[model samples]
Target chain A: MQVRCPHCASVFPSDRAGTQFCPRCGAQIHVPEEGQVVEAGLPPFAPGAPPEPSGAEGPGPGEGPTPALPPGVREPTPWERRRELGLFKAVVETWKASVLSPRRFWPSVRPEAPWTEALLYGWLIGAVTSIASIPLRVWQQRRSVDELREAAERLEELPARLRDILRPIVESAGAGTTGDVVAQAILGALLWPVGFIILAAVLHLCCLLVGASRGGFGATARAVGYAWGPMVILYLPFIGWLGWVYAAVLAAWGVKELHETTWERAVGAVVIPFVVVCCFACCLGMAGVGAAFSSLRASP
Target chain B: MHLHLPPRNRTFGFVDALGVTGAVGLAIARWVPVARIVPFWGCVLREQTGWPCLGCGLTRAADRFAHGDFIGALQANPLGAVAAAFFALCVVASALHLAFGVPLPEVRLSPREARGARWALVVAVVLNYAFVVVQTRFPHLLA
Candidate 1:
């Protein structure tokens, strides 16, 4: 159930329904059941990204071997070339990974620590730190809310645009009464913190289901979308095109699985559908208009 | 712009656990004061000095903030005000969402705007710290 990634020092849930690699960071996770696949090796730093150069620590370079510079001058050997390339490649990839791109790092659910551990370990690791930091947290929370509040006021046509953006995502969530959809969204907006926490918790559970659990939820910001439903509040201030995007992603992820889980867990099941319908509708709508316009032009 | 809420709302699994954790924390803070956690009598390094340490009143400050005594909370720790306000917002907003499917459509800030907001908060906290230092050094400044 618990597997550690040698490269990243990460603990993951490896007891998958089937074989799975490290889902978070691409690493060769040893899955006991996967006897033959073990040799498949770690998903390279990236597919087709190329390995390190020869003569360096990583995979050798692409060159067969360094050729003689001139009749007298000597050249680096293949092993040397490979080593240099590998090291260079590794450093570059690490830097790229470290300096996050919104596209790569910021997803719908960022994931936080395992709820059980984050809270408990927090209690032990000097509760004062938690207690003392309350003010800072408060400051941050209010700052976020205040921003949302103003944005809501300034954007007079937010509803219309939101509808356009939200429609497709909503449709995907599943069918819902207008009131129900609105209420679910509003609920998501209001109790986002709790929603955020619960969202992370549920996501963690899902990761376990998939057998590629992440270690700690990590920082709150990192786990931002892990609890997408409540993050609506977080977007309140932005109330812009980007804010709408966050809302759509959260709703879509939350609702996508609602129908399946609704039967087993009636209440959460309801939310899942609601989120799905809303997010799906928004995404589809956005895509649909582009398609319609393009098709119109083509017909002419 | 238009905001939408799902007509129906449902609770998730983390609710019960969060509730229990929060309740237990609140109970401990209320019933057992932090100072009591220390021994009543012992030879201590700070025994010779009468002044409180920088972090002395923080626990009480948190307790007061949690209890909703905003003024008392601020007096205990300036950061207490911000924390109290935020915590109240969180609790209120969450309760509203639970009772009614729609969350209270409140305000928010994007990262861009927060640049200015961050400064404002910094100034407030700094001023609060100044007040604390002044009061501690010159008790008469309290008047």
Candidate 2:
């Protein structure tokens, strides 16, 4: 039977009798989606395109479990539809746009975009999180030794793991401030990966909400990893560069193969070399242009 | 998030820049005997009573791991050693995908699973922080 939502006036078919709120208008009437206890959210562009009316009308080709939208939702730009499922996200697409191509750090600051916010926020959050954990830690510390042990035991493997992280800090705290800073640094590195993901995601979602950009956790991680992940590791001895190089090259290839990439592995091969060459050509062109412009003089 | 990727020099952006920096930083630190760097940092950490820490040898660990010495990497820091292994796997899988027309490596989670995983990770971290604090204050019982 077709249920008409009194609010937004959208009429979609319901498999059962009773209905609830009109999703279109936020009105809570007595209508629901057939027998569905929970239903999917309405589509983004679904204002006009209602679901198939009741049974008398007919079943639509892409009805019921709505047909998947073409992988790329952008306008009429035609691209091949991969025969296999992608590896999680269109990682290759994201990689190409964000990591490989360079300009992809949208919504977030650009390389040249002032570092004011990021640096300030990073430091502030780092310090705050560090200080905040102190009391929480202290309260737990107050518990009986046996109780704490039991809790730690119950925790499986995480206590020792977490203790290893705080050892230097705790040991140093017996002394003074220098140790505190070191403690913070150690803590910062340990926590940054997880915290950064959340921060980046929030920033990205805000961007999307405002029609500013599609930045998200994945993109932010890639960007931060690209810019700072290496720099942080740069403090290491001789082999530090090796890690950075490895990460860099891997990131590059990943970006090149992001789009139309399958979860299987071979598609990346086809994409990388082509991208590498294309990348090389673009570099030469940029250099050539730079040289030409730098030596500019009137034809006279 | 909507990210605006400005133009970048592939030859010298993060990957390239970090490589050069790491090589130079390592060389300089090694040669300079700088009193304010990693080893020094380690010494200073030692001076402290050591509340406990996870990444004690991470920098060195990453250094060693990067050089293809998995054992050396572990010596520096086991966690970093693990991370290095994951990175290597990612590289091999990605490289193969790039070199041939193979599909990409299996992504760990679908969008739904991923969303769920993220929140779980956050909870784990907070709990970890609490665990560390408690352990530092009372080590014997757990130890």
Candidate 3:
């Protein structure tokens, strides 16, 4: 039987009964059995439809009156104040829920959550991940030492001029000690707030450019901060890329939910910045290659 | 029964294209001696752990495989040659799918088969690393 997705309005055949997510857009859909009454008040499927006005503009069906906040004071969110459940427990729970079900989680979040709390969460996750990577970092340092020793042995066989030229470079590269690793971890944790602020600003600008800035800068910042929940898995080898992708997905979903914007707008806001960064990296890489070639050609 | 799902987003196609471009670039670099003159960015994992990670030496191994040194490629990392071949197939498959709307068959593996595949991959990685260790520590055995 053919089923029309209520979210994207894409029609696809579904043989199985009951609730299933639309493959096209990952929206939840429920298919009823024969003679069953279709759910009432469900939004009708409309292709390329503009998003409905949020409760902030007008009271939508079943939506309550929008809450008012005093100037310069942001209300604490449940996720931020779950101290009764213990701080670590609350953080882990929040991270798990946000990462696993971002669509549902983000929509439920109060727009008034302080950006500072979000930044702290992001920093804490970064610090935890860095600490988790200590064992791997130590092993890597040991391997580096062995390689340096081997290189030194080989360097002894080279001519005096060649040896003199390469020795200093090799020595500098092999200078990573355990103290360096600890310092890097501390620095990474401390600098995470800066990264979060920059990311939030970029995304907020993108949202404004895309005409989806409904909840203001604070809302966007909060969304960006909470969306970094997936960074908890940054210590995992090989699969760490998954954490980055998941974080991006969460950020897009969070933006959409908090702004009450369409999926297209949210995705555009998230992905445009990423595409720009990639293009910039590619250009820099090409410039570097050109410079190297020029230097190689100029050398005697 | 096979379930045919909806077509994925063009972003996935773009990502696949990038992967194909990189693999093809690396393959071409194998034949060009000038490419070999580029500075080596040694693996961070290998430098830290005193052992090669799963992806260590993949570029060089792929280059060797492209130059018809299958044994050397295997010695460098068996997983690298396999991954190169797999990715090469993916490039062709993705191109065909994108251009002609040809759908690739989705193989649904049984639990046993999935477990077996995972174990096989683990074995390949372990055996490859063991070979590397032996070659590095006791060169005369391989010689």
Candidate 4:
């Protein structure tokens, strides 16, 4: 019996049962049961071309044929798709996308990317910000020194002993500030990983207490790491504070998405730790004040 | 290619590196006699208002502490030695974590504990800053 290849429109003798490739064109052909006539005159079906609409009913205007796909293929996830462009590009693109649309972007990031990559991403961003701010820091420091000098000059009317004491403090201003830029950059980069760990632990604890910790610690860490995306703008003058606020918002969004929890829970997870830390700080301040008062009372 | 280290291990590595770098920096600062040549950006608050900030002299103090000058470190800034100790501890903890997969214990403070810790830090900073201010402003009082 003869068969026609639907894909290449090649005609060949059908010697095998079930499915077979056309001998002339290599198009897959399905052999029929006995007594079926082969349609040998149909046009060849291009491998990647979309299937034509049924006879007498073509696709209407604005309706395009769907692209053909090989079997067993699936669309890439957002992270995988972004990563396909290369690491640097992926980092830049992801950071941009995250800053612009954190609500949408963060939810799309699954916990599949290694947490270390996220930590590195956060650290690099922090380091860039620190390096960029070196000039500003230097300017601020110089201004401070000038102000100190003026203050010391004003103290010239005080007792000679007082002047002697202030002299060393004022004079020491000129020492050991040269390599500060490198120090700041290294410290900034190094602090990020530690910060992330602390943040993750606090947030995870809060989530657990609040009964919203559906996701594991890994997911929470990933969320916090990606939340540092907004820190890319930390070098921007005046508006730099906004970057931190945006980062906080993004972190909440990330927690919500990653943990599949309520918005309140996510926000609480982030905010509660901060509140606790603040409370602790306040208590310490009060105790310091009380102690100072006690010492003053004890003094003549 | 990405590193095969787990996230926790990577974090440990970063913290450990930071601690080492800080220790090394302190060590160098102790040995180097280039203090007069290097510009010290002293405390801006003190420069502007004649009052020392909480962190004033911290770098110098840390350097002194790293060099085993405990008295000098205390006089420079009491908290400096504490900060140096923290960095040292971080280094040790990170090493243990990396080698044994043992993680830092999670802090789960009760409300009372949180309040106490916060108050303690606040008091420490305030008292320290007060000491600095008095020591700088009234050098005769100490005598």
Candidate that would win on DockQ: 4
The CA lDDT of each predicted structure is: 0.38, 0.37, 0.62, 0.59
A25-125 per-residue lDDT for model 4 (tens digits): 65444567782545432221223432211111111122233223211111122334555687677777768767777644654465434556666667767
lDDT of 1 at A49: 29
lDDT of 3 by residue, A1-300 (tens): 777665566778888766566798775656666624323213221234322211122222232343332111122434587777778787877787788766556655655445567777777777788777878777777787789978988987765655654576578768878888778877887777656665776676566545455565556777887888887766666777788888898888878776666788789889978987675455446544554454456545
TM-score of chain A of each: 0.22, 0.22, 0.64, 0.59
Q: In model 1, which regions exceed 4 Å deviation?
A: A1-300, B1-25, B38-56, B65-70, B106-108
Model 2 stretches with alpha carbons more than 4 Å out? A1-300, B1-40, B43-46, B108-143
lDDT of 2 by residue, A1-300 (tens): 666664455776666654245556554434443543333322212244221111111111222322332211121000111124243233233334333443222211222222222333334434444565554434433443445445544544434444443344344333334445456556875666445443333333322222212112233233333333223233344554554454444433322222111222212332334455465455445544443343343212
Q: Give the docking tier of candidate 1.
A: incorrect
Question: Per-residue lDDT tens digits of candidate 3, residues B87-124?
Answer: 56766765766767665443333334434544666688
Evaluate model 1: give its TM-score: 0.32
lDDT of 1 by residue, B1-143 (tens): 12223344433223332333344445555677654443222112112243433333455676876676767777877775565455455454445557675433322223233334445656876776666666666668788
Model 1 Cα shift for residue A190 (angstroms)? 28
Q: Give the per-residue lDDT digits (tens) of candidate 1, residues A107-223.
A: 211122223322332222223333333444455555545665555455444345444433443343333334553454445344434434544444433322222121222322123
Q: Please state the CAPRI-style docking class of candidate 4.
A: incorrect
Error of 1 at B10 (Å): 4.6
